[model samples]
Target: MTDGEPIPEERGAPHRGAVWGAAAWSAGVLVLLVALPWAARHRLPDPLATHWGGHDPDGSMSPTGAALFPAGTWLVLVLATAALHRFGRRAATGRARGATGAALAAGGVLLTGAQASIVHANLDHARWQDADPVGTAVAAVVAASALAGLLTWLAARPRGATPAGPRPTPGAPVMAVPPGEQVVWLSRVVNPWLQLTAAVLGVCAMGGLLAPASGLIALNWSLVVPFASTSVIVLACSSVRARVTARGLHLGFGPFGWPARRWSPADLESARAEQRGPAQAGGWGYRINGLGTTVMLRRGTCLVVRNRRGAEFAVSLDDAERGAALLNSLIARSDRTAVTHGDDHR
Candidate 1:
């Protein structure tokens, strides 16, 4: 395949297990949420004290309604998350499917646990009046969500490297590497979860405005703030443009000339094409962890560049081999020019 073209992952893929596991885990959690509350229906108060505030039960819903809300809401969440992921996966060259699955499952667990805790706190007491339903609900959502995120992260462990078709060209310094060449590589990715999250938060934020006193404003704000901030942050990180100039290599978020990473040709250490799967980035696009910064716009071949400090920066682009070739060629040309200038000065 050409270097810039995404490697077709229809072959053996590492994230396959993670994706299937996500499907199973999400469905299982939803099932448990649905079944457990119904089984405990009889034990619950007739009109469950579903909402509590200031150490008093201020709001109540029929026990049947209380049980149904979490089940129904989470069911929709799972479906929406899954469907968005199905399309986003194709659009972005099969990236972040695991993360989308995990997020859906984790969100379901949090909502389910919140309902369960709120209901149980009221039911188990001799006087349902003593239970603080809202407090328990909030705490349960936070704690359970944290645990679910950790579990999802662990579950996403890389199974293996994705095979990128035939053996790649060696990373050795090629004598024919073109130097003084001008080249640009551009790529962009969309994470459906971000837009899905934005929609959910925007809705909740509006709901908060409807009844300012219900504490939903506070509750929804809590969710909206961080999620919105993260979405905006990654928004910049996901869309990228890479260029190899006479000066060096450049990476940036936009066509704007400002705010770009320019690597002086002298600092250029090595460039090679790497084949990776979603497992490598632990989901998708602009993943910056212990592995350094990975601008994964698509799967298959990527151009990874290392500087004098040994730090690696990678971007998934079409014709990665060609990009790497161009980078090395530029480095070679720069060195040759530097040497020629040095001899002339002497």
Candidate 2:
């Protein structure tokens, strides 16, 4: 290949064991979700109470409709999550694969559980006029439990080691600006997509506030705070600067940045350049998927840095290989210094 050609990767096949296991869990929840209403069909009266205002149901629907909504939602979640799991697993590998699949499956299960609890609370042996028992605590408990389970599952799951990835070219570093004369490699990356998305959100919030309907205006007005705030941030701080200085590797907005994330040579174990597609990082922005933490701005070649604690930090930008090589070199130099100092002390 040419001198500047990017390294190719050995993107391995999906983990069928994890895929099937997650699918099975999703399917089980779906079946249970469907079965609850189907078995209780006889007990549920016509025009079942499906909507709740306070502790009691205020609105009603046909038993079949009530049953179908949750059932259908479960079915859709399972199918959609399964597809995401399959595609997500492809980009992820090892423990990330297992963790991602588990996260997806657990998320789907929690949704099903939350919905099931609300639905079950409404189920009773009488005609449809507020006969069912309900409470604020019950709803709160269900939500809290489901959230706890999701977090617990995520925490318990390992971040996993990076799989066998494509290797960087032997001598071709992406951005090896000779630090001999000048002592740093500095670059900037602006996220136009984030700006665009934030703009759209702001416009939607404005439109919602201007909406004729009172409820619509309330919803729109509610959005205005977060949307406008986020828009301002995106416009003002969407750009990130990567600097490799004498100290170590630095990434943030600028000298004093917004994110304020820095990695010292002593803190990191290794760094490597790899091709990071959108799927690999499990979406965009500062995402925390199975791969650990990713500061994704643009998708392409990126630097994956593994810290002493084994967590990975990834950033996608121009001349990623040079940055990675420089960081790795810095880490090696620091290690040698520490070893030499330790022997001298002895």
Candidate 3:
């Protein structure tokens, strides 16, 4: 087993232990959101204050509505994430799982905190409008939600993510560049599964962005902004283009290729073609597991590179052999040039 490879336990989707843990955690969160408000029903006003405008209450819902609203939203969120875990291209990956867990954790906290605040404010009030200002409580709730999300993300990160990988392969394929010849290799890969996921998120974001006009839900910029931003990011990462030239490897991302990464030949320790899969690379898209950073679109042949620090970076693509060969050749050429310069100076 190489240093960066996934162990037997890390290869598959939806581990049994993880499933049960998530279910239990979800149940706990649901209970907190529902039970707290219901338990305090006797003290709260018949119609509880829900939406606050500035310092005063501006919107209200029945005691039953108040209890069920946040809980219902939480339930929907849980179900959506559950579907994603079961069906998403790389949802089972450590990074994906951690992201899902973190979102749920933060959402659970926000829902439960809001419910608790509402119940507390409405206590001993004759009317929903008379409820005390909950600005401080709202701030506290947001802080707690953020903290919980961060903690969950940190806890779920893959353990022992050391920057170690397979040793440099001397037998790896290489291409020879003629003395004055210009060689450039271009390769691109697109993940339809990721594109589909991004499209779905984009549709949802569009709906959320327009929901305010519909007057169906109390949808606001706070919810729409993050959702839309996420959609854009996912769409941007759905496709990747790799270009190898005398300058080194240039990776362009998305259709427009706005965000890209470049690595000079001198910066790479070694380049090789390695057979890998989502199971081995810890799921799809961009990932960093024990295997280091992998821009894994689909699994199979990957152009893997190790920097001087022994840190590995990989990208799954077709004709990876040619790409790796060209990269390795460039590195070799750069090394020869450096050695020649050194000898001249001496």
Every candidate's CA RMSD = 12.0, 16.9, 14.1
Compared with the true structure, what per-residue lDDT tens digits does model 2 show for residues 249-336? 8776511255667888899898877878778788766678898777777777777889999999887756667667767767777798
Q: Write down the TM-score for model 2.
A: 0.43
Q: What does the lDDT read for residue 52 in candidate 1?
A: 68
Select the stronger candidate by lDDT from 2 and 3. Answer: 3
Sorted by TM-score (best first), the order is 3, 2, 1
Q: lDDT per model, in order?
A: 0.57, 0.57, 0.73
In model 3, residue pairs whose N, Cα or C atoms come closer than 3 Å (at least 3 residues apart or on different chains), thus clashing, are none
Give candidate 2's whole-model lDDT: 0.57
Ranking by lDDT: 3, 2, 1
Q: In candidate 1, what are the lDDT values of residues 133-247, reduced to their tens digit?
A: 4675577567867776665544332222222443236664442533333444333223334334433443333233222222212345665566556644543443455656455
Give the poorly placed runs of model 2, Cα more than 4 Å off: 1-182, 203-221, 232-238, 253-256
User: Candidates 1 and 2: which is better by lDDT?
Assistant: 2
Please report the candidate that would top lDDT against the real structure.
3
Model 1 stretches astray by more than 4 angstroms: 1-25, 28-47, 53-55, 58-67, 81-110, 116-120, 133-182, 186-318
Superior candidate under lDDT, 1 versus 3: 3
For each candidate in turn, the TM-score is: 0.43, 0.43, 0.50
